[model samples]
Target: MPTLDPTQLETLVVIAEEGTFDAAARRLHITPSAVSQRIRALERAAGQVLVRRTTPCTPTEAGEPLIRQGRQLRLLLAEAAATLKTGDTDDTVVDLSVVVNADTLATWFRPVLDEVATWDRTALRITVEDQGYSADALRRGEVLAAVTSEPKPVQGCTVEPLGRLRYTPGATPALVERYRKGRGIDWSAMPMIVYNEKDHLQDEVLAAHRATRPPVVHRVPSSHDFHEAIRRGLGWGMLLDAQAEADLASRTTIPLPGAKPIDIQLFWQRWRLDSIALDDLSEAVRRAARSGLRPTRPL
Candidate 1:
């Protein structure tokens, strides 16, 4: 079996995180030339092009396992330090990078993170992506875990049902008035709000209503702004139930009739490892989801 040099493996992981040889060298407190040499030697030992020479460098298929190994080693070292009561400082804190969707970030995800705050030895680095594409971040090794809509686990990750987030078609009273004035909502001609180009909820709602044409979508990427846009009558869009709470009570927004709300089933995807921090964080998230979301229904 081929053995990887520890220094070379660490170099690969740092380069992947820092995105360039110079940046990796700066992080490791070495010359950029030394970083290059270490990577070259590592590639020779592996007998493959481990790192793709891109603008912001990325790992090849052969490099992923080594990168993961490097991460695992760091975690183990942190665990050992914590166990030994050694002179480990805050520098030993584990940084857990996770990907989550915008809606979750705005609503239920915050309270879950409060649990993570109790772990003084760990810090979370969060990446926001659409629920539909979050698993791709995990597959690419960009994050340690993710909240994704996909039930299928990524290559080395374990997946479990979190719960469902319901989204209802919502519009301002003014927009509703306009919609009701017509014989029916001319959805194709009406202005609509969407999170971004990647958002499909609006189109799905339109399809469910049998509206054949696409609307003039107003893209509001920020979650707060997206809600505000609809609240201010920019366009009609689906609002997550939690978000719709205030609007529903105030009668500022009304649900469009004849359309069933979209219930997005979410799942937790994380590495199938026995790290204490990961385990604790996952349990906290699961607990929060159980309390905040609808239970996942059996198919």
Candidate 2:
């Protein structure tokens, strides 16, 4: 590595996160040509192509290292500046944004917040997303951390296996008797409620039967609403063990036949910054995930 220009390094980080050279240049109040020149200069210095310019840009393997380093440098500089002022910590709420699933929030994930409150920090800004999709937010720098279904690490982040969250195929008793007796879906004929247009809960179950696709679909976006829709017999859907246990015990739920089940393996993806505050937060989240999500077992 040759001598790095902090300005160019910042530009590269911005471009990678913002997804385009024009966007990054706009952010820095510099001309797009200037941004391009700086990037070209940086690439000459590094002797490798850093970014692959596509519709939405993607970092090369080489670019990821610089992007991650840039983020760490920025975070360390901010922490140092904050410490120098001491009182600046309380200036405004330092929002710590994170992407998490709705059920995990309703489950033991809250314990992480208890730990967060124990530390001296600012307000939390939580963004609920489907576990599978949270990594996009991390790459866009929209969130500092995420509880993701993906095991792969996002650029500028560290990935830790948080464990699996087991989901049981469940439905209300009345719904069960009405749908499970002999009607048991075959999945194609079953009327199923889904989380949204993009949800695949029913498809996952139906795929086991070698069915083509779900015939009936109802979209409810909220996890609580999704559970309630199943409980009300609107349609059957998969319920997370942590969220459905009480209902299942009270006989409100009737489990679907066949032992095959879906377990979503979650991971903690976070910026690998050396902030004491972030370290404490990562530990808290890890502890909560260990207790909240179930261990992965052979299906």
lDDT of every model, 2 decimals: 0.86, 0.77
Tens-digit per-residue lDDT, 1-299, candidate 2: 59988788888888876889999989999999999999999899899999898968877878777775665666666666666666655453344668898878878699987866765435567898888788887875656789998888986689988888888887777765655535454556556887876677667887787766556677888888888888888877888788788998997877876626688888899987767767777888888877887865444
Best by lDDT: 1
Scored against the true structure, residue 181 in model 2 reaches a CA lDDT of 38
Q: Write the per-residue lDDT of candidate 1 for residues 89-163, one digit (tens) a residue.
A: 535678788999999999888877888888777879999999999998887777889999999999889999999
lDDT of 2: 0.77
Candidate 1: segments with Cα more than 4 A from true spot: 88-90, 181-183, 212-215
Question: What is the total number of backbone clashes in candidate 1?
Answer: 0
Alpha-carbon deviation at 240 in model 1, angstroms: 0.7
The residue pairs that clash in candidate 1, if any, are: none
